[model samples]
Target: MPQLTLYGYYKSSCTTRLRIALALKKIEYTTVFIDFFNKEHRGAAYAAINPNMSLPTLAADEGDGQGPVYITQSVAALEYLEEAFPDNGVHLLPNNAADRARVRSLVEVVVADLQPRQAAQTLEKLGNDFNANQDQKVKWAYDWCIKELQAYETLVTATGLAGKYSVGDTLTLADVCLVPGIQNAVERWGVDLDKDFPALAKIYENLKAVPEVQGAHWSQQPDAPKE
Candidate 1:
């Protein structure tokens, strides 16, 4: 078994994806909190660990006389976890090929389509180069998030694959990816999930009840602010 260390920030949705996957798989790991607000990710030390300077970098040590394996990108880490420890806990990917593709489609809607647009670095550049104000940046992220989520909702309904979770009855990587994005959309962007996306709203509600999902929520992270 490889010893794992996850480097992430509390509020980062991308980080939340890995957190959920880790919790679901019953994987034990150490968390090295990266303070995104203080520009810790941009420092030289973290940059060496992850050249992309992004949150949720997974470091794995097999203790088999080999160097540690570092995985950046949230989707990649989720896939790695699924493959490396397929029997650790519940299987995130489906048994069939088509169902696996469906799961990946939903995951991509949040990870690839929407998340990058709302990333802190992108928003910072929006303010620096494009002169976007704080409100404008929030709106910018909100619009993209809503659009992607609407597409996700449509896919779920159109394909008729959604059940209690994102794909059928099993909690796949799609649900892991969706929870954090939905959190940002509703909490930060004030998206009326009930009104705007009913299918997603219901699915989000069901996912909220999941123990692993709840544990991996931003509010549950160690670095989260006290209320």
Candidate 2:
């Protein structure tokens, strides 16, 4: 394995997810910060790395004759890491196909369903298209996020997948997706996790104590905004 490089913004929830995955996998890597506020992701240099102009692009050295492999999108990067580093001892997906499907579904609840709607771009578009004020835009995003969080809580309980983690006893991609969304809800949108979503709050509390999760927290990132 050659050196790994991660390109992302510290404040992005998607980027935070990849950071947690890398930490859990114990992969040593370097970071190239893309300043989100300054539109650094749109620059020609980063555009060459990820044509989509997305955050959390990964470059992995394939060693030997193979050159560096570039992966974009947080979920895709995570799946790539799981497949490329299978023997590294950290598995993000379960071996059981059914369990894996369940985990993926939970992950989608956050990644596809929740995260996109709450993204800055989406919210900005919503505000412009609807002529909504800042408060209205925030309320709109918060409402949808709360709805999804409630759905996630129900899914965990109904499926009996609630254990020490999101889907089971061990950590999975679902937990990776869950933690950051919860963090954004609480810190960014002022959602009350403990009072409103106790199940997710419990899971969030437990996961926050984990060293990898704690280390990957947005506040701990080098490019996080200072007080």
Candidate 3:
């Protein structure tokens, strides 16, 4: 077994997703925090680790000849983790060809459309595009997100998610992609899941109550939106 270390930011949705997966797998690792909000990711030290200057870099080190394997992207990191250590023999992708396609399709909708929309809202708050109004930007983003969420609701509800997890009553990369986006929609974007999306609301609720999520340490001091 190799010792793993993750370099990521606290508020980064991609980082949060990797943290949840790490906890679920029970893989022990040290987290080196980088502050994306303060633009620490743009610094030279991080640039050396990942030229793309992205968060959530994975490194595996063992005492032997095995050096370190560095991975920058979130989905890429997760796929590597699933392949390397598969507990319960339940894979992120399904064993069946059709099932794998379905899961990939569902994830594609969110990854392609949902999270990037939220990222624009996040940047507006950070004053990235000065002309973009934060309130208007967030509202627009959420509207797009909920439209996709509704479509996902139809997909999941029809796919037998109620039994246990996102695909086939078991946890998968689908759940990994899902949990973080829901967190963004609820915590960061201030979208009300109960009102906007019931099926996904249930999925969120279910994932939260899972033993792994309940035990997983989210932010040390979690805050709700101020009234």
Candidate 4:
């Protein structure tokens, strides 16, 4: 068994993705909540752990003489966990190289292209630096997120890669990335997934039905605000 510790905030989409991956992998982990609202992630202590001071920093014990390995960035952490615990948990990537590439391409559409543009940091910066109001911020987030989903919908339809989940029947890394992106689009930006993106709406519905995915939901996380 690997000793794993995950440091993250509840509402962060990146952190939520890691949570979904961990739950799906059936990996036992200790979670340390970093309160982003209070700027806890930017403090000196967290800075020492992750120079990037990003949410969802993962620390893992490899059982080698190298001691614990600390990883930052959501995608890198997920890939590391997949490689380290390949046999024990759900396979996140496909066996075929071409299929793996396709899966990664889908993952990138969310992780690299969509999520970053809608990140809290980016939105906050837009407000502070560009003097964007709340309505403007919402519009900016909604426009970019919807634009990306439009492209994603087209890609999935063109490639016929989606099944019960993205990129096939098995829940790959693409699903891990997709769910949280859609959640952010719906919850934060108030974009109607069902009305705007039917393909993604279907994928989101299927993903929500999975127990592990449900377990990893932002609303169910330890640090999520009580309603």
Q: Among these predicted structures, which one has the highest TM-score?
A: 1
Model 4 gets an lDDT of 0.89
The alpha-carbon deviation from the true structure for residue 161 of candidate 2, after best TM-score superposition, in angstroms, is: 0.9
47-130: candidate 2 lDDT, tens digit per residue: 997998988899988786677788888999999889888877589999999999999999999998999988988888877898
Candidate 1's C-alpha runs over 4 A off are none
- Model 2 alpha-carbon drift over 4 Å, by segment: 64-66
C-alpha lDDT of all candidate models, in order: 0.91, 0.89, 0.74, 0.89
Candidate 1, residue 135: lDDT: 99
- Residues 117-175 of candidate 1 have per-residue lDDT tens digits of 88888899999999999999999999998899999999999989879888998999999
TM-score winner between 1 and 4, please give it: 1
> Cα lDDT for residue 21, model 1?
90
TM-score of 1: 0.98
Clashing pairs in 2: none
Cα RMSD, model 3: 3.5
Each candidate's clash count: 0, 0, 0, 0
Better of 3 and 4 by lDDT: 4
What TM-scores do the predictions have?
0.98, 0.95, 0.84, 0.96
Kindly indicate the candidate among 1 and 2 with the higher TM-score. 1
Q: When superposed on Cα atoms, how far off is each prediction in RMSD?
A: 0.9, 1.4, 3.5, 1.2
Q: Give the alpha carbon lDDT tens digit for every residue of 1-227 in model 3.
A: 77788987766777777877887777778888787777888899989878888777988776587687888888788778877787723467778878877777777777777877677345565466566666777777778777877878878787665446667677777787788788777776778899977777777778988666554434641321234
- The TM-score, computed over Cα atoms with residue i paired to residue i, of candidate 2 is 0.95
- Model 4 residue runs over 4 Å out of place are none
